[model samples]
Target: MATISEQNASSISPVIRLHRSDDVVIARSQLVGGTVLQEEGVTVSGLVPPGHKIAVRAIGQGQPVRRYGQIIGFASRPIAPGEHVHTHNLAMGEFQRDYAFCADAKPTRVADGNATFDGIVRPDGRVATRNYIGILTSVNCSATVARAIADRFRRDIHPEALGAYPNIDGVVALTHGVGCAVDAEGEALEILQRTLGGYVVHPNFAAVLVIGLGCETNQIARLVEKQHLEALVSTGRLSTYNIQETGGTVKSIERGVELVQGLLAKANDARREPVPASHLVVGLQCGGSDGYSGISANPALGAAVDLLVAHGGTAILSETPEIYGAEHLLTRRALNAQVAEKLVARIRWWEDYCARNHASLDNNPSAGNKAGGLTTILEKSLGAVAKGGTTNLVDVYEYAQPVHAKGFVFMDTPGYDPISATGQVAGGANLICFTTGRGSAYGCAPTPSLKIATNEALWQRQQDDMDLNCGPILAGTKTIEEVGAELFQLMLQVASGQRSRSEIHGYGQNEFVPWQIGAIT
Candidate 1:
């Protein structure tokens, strides 16, 4: 009788060939002292450390390095057949290239017929997946008052579906780290102002009340002057107030709560009505990832993102640092080669950025990531890009800028989740979808966030925080496609007024971190 193949059927058969013409394999697990890998009836190589690569053939300098069927890097030196290939001999190719914007983002004509989610219709003609009353602080001095106002509501009342406003969600107070002691004309001021302005005008918010101490540099009046919002809430009109103009904290809190209550009454009149899927903007992000992240959550999320795009919605893939190694895959799919080149340029910029700061892009895969089995940033990045799916690269955006592209687009941001999600939120993401392999307690203000867990143990351990468990893929229970679709469904529910664990626990707002890029001096 033929011997049963000893290769464990449930274990991920190591992808030994990424390109048909290539011959290198990544180690799936740590090898015993003298393990040998056999491929195509030939001994390809001996045991290699997990996450390291070994060649079955020779490569020369300038030759492309392939992984996951994509160009991950290039050979920096000559290598004999069957030699180990890694950082010592490979590096990202730095090149100059032209960028084309919107050239390849050919206005996609979305499929006219598609299912619509029940959503909150905004007076701005923008369909919103959420209906929230936002209490915004213009400066840190107002942070306490803002939180106090929210507390009054959360502690005092359980929302009863108000007539005509059955869709109204609870109150949220958004406070942040900045808004004090910054240059008035610098990028920080502009970003801080725009972010505040953007949230005030956000479709997800039905009512917004500004709270501030008045003298702070991030003046509410300037925000009013800039956005021409003297006529605030022109559509389904509601109360707009500022605390500084009020006598003091006690009066401001009382007045803010009254205004919030009235707005809640008005917002409660709204009911979820059917709207096209295109109204949804999902922010795709990955953090606390491991070796299995790319193989599981990221790709699974990518598949879900593609499905959302197919249904005529939007998906934003962010975190500039995380995109480092796999930018080539994104470049090829660039709406145009120029858009492709733009992405390539960003990748190149990050290289010098890290080098100058005396840091290494590979310095990531933090202690947590390493403990969870990730070996390098390249390994992490290759997994992170899987969340964007196989969609054509449609557009690239700078930090926190508006994204009007209909399909998948890239947003520039640091790998830090708070700041990254903050930018994505300002860029018009209605909902943030985050995947974590080692489990992260991440949240986004104004916009709702749904967390997808990478491993089952982590999911079960943190069931109160995790919204979706992707560990089934590792447990021989489910496929990436199925879990992905399930996640998409959960996203729709959250968009349509279902409270995620984060929302229920009020875990957002505190996480808003703008990418601060200057010296304090």
Candidate 2:
């Protein structure tokens, strides 16, 4: 904590620093224009942005500056205590890293064996968070056919003939890029097949129908051979038909509708029962962030993330740009140096990636973010990282790639909400936990998503969209731990098939925007 006069308790440093050689203090509240506060026994000299740092102690040349109990960076020159710390005095420097053997993590076995949620268990040794029959398109050529089949089978509109299917969530068309242009055996094509393959076995799915255009590169046969998707076909849990093989769009849609109706019959037989909380993987993301986000909603969500982790569950944090200046915080908590190295390497790649593309990572604090009092990418990043909680970063992954780590894993992705959410879903995340200060009424695909508001005002204002309120942290009413426990409880309900407001209003079907990386010809 930074030193301050007794006359002003409000002038205290924001974070609990673990290192004695630290020269900076995290801002607890928004430090806006013209507001001066004394820190570390120094007179007011310069203004410090919220989520940014102010020097708390003096450091000589070539000294290590610590935050989160590790070297985030080093000093540029001699600096006195209580000076503002920004890009001028700090820079990103490379250091030798040890990428040693990374084995299975030993999270202590939770003694609360009774901590189970009512979930629909499947025969595949996996538990379901929701019960939905999915219509997945193998190629863009079959997208319309898949959608048409869904339209004809929706119980709400066509309740006359679909007598066997009961309470069925309407069909979702999972379509994407790279099914046609890529080489048949390429890595990109292989990744797409596995992602779709994973979804067929997803516990949330009760039944699956694969719709394809036979002429396309991504044939369903490869999915079986490459990903061993034959189990789905053998158990009568999945069926595949192609438009070119059938005839035309009209004939394919008719065939798809009949096949989906049969799958729906098998899916409706499932019922919810007690299941462990460890099956739940909450995907934490935020978009349209503002200054209030770090101080209110993000940290509150962080507390919720901690509860889930403590319960032997998993929480994933994504959106690369959102974590720009705050990547160092996560690095120190990395269980081993390899996980930390993987995270930093991704950051380095993004820096070079931006430079090559003529884009700046800092050019993101959108008009909405600026209006909400966020001044820089540095300030927003510090706040945005709060959603990951205090857990060690166990693993890291690329865009739209499967998340291999348990507890807390970082996936590299752009800050766009819809695309980022898409990558998370493809990475095997079943539930998305989103926090917003400016109040985005957002939702994702077939996977259930929970919206949390950063403050009380946003929660009340957008009562219909928000599922939980971290506003008490802003109002000094509820501690983060209290709100976090409640969030974990709500996750179980969501996993058990309880509907969020956005889901009730049909939010999942259209949010699928795959990350289109590399050059498009």
Which candidate's lDDT is highest? Answer: 1
Question: Model 2: clashing residue pairs?
Answer: 23-56, 297-454
Each prediction's TM-score versus the true structure:
0.82, 0.80
lDDT tens string, model 1, 1-521? 00001122244454233344444554455444334455533333444545356665677889876555555567888865555666667666644322334333444444445756788887668877777788888887888888888877663264442334545666778887667688877877787777777777778888788777878787877877775666775543434455658888899989887777667666776667878788898988887876557666776788788778888888998888987766665775687866776787777788888889898876776887766655456556777888887677888887878788889899888898888888888788999999987788877767889988877777888888889887776554677778878887787888877888888787786886667764433
Tell me the lDDT of model 2 at 448: 89
lDDT against the true structure, per candidate, is: 0.72, 0.71
Single out the weakest 10-residue window by summed lDDT for candidate 2.
1-10
Residue 202 in model 2: lDDT: 72
Q: Which stretches of candidate 1 lie over 4 Å from their true place?
A: 1-66, 69-113, 155-166, 233-244, 344-360, 475-477, 519-521
lDDT of 1 at 509: 67
Lowest summed lDDT window (length 10), candidate 1? 1-10
Per-residue error at 214 for model 1, in Å?
A: 1.4
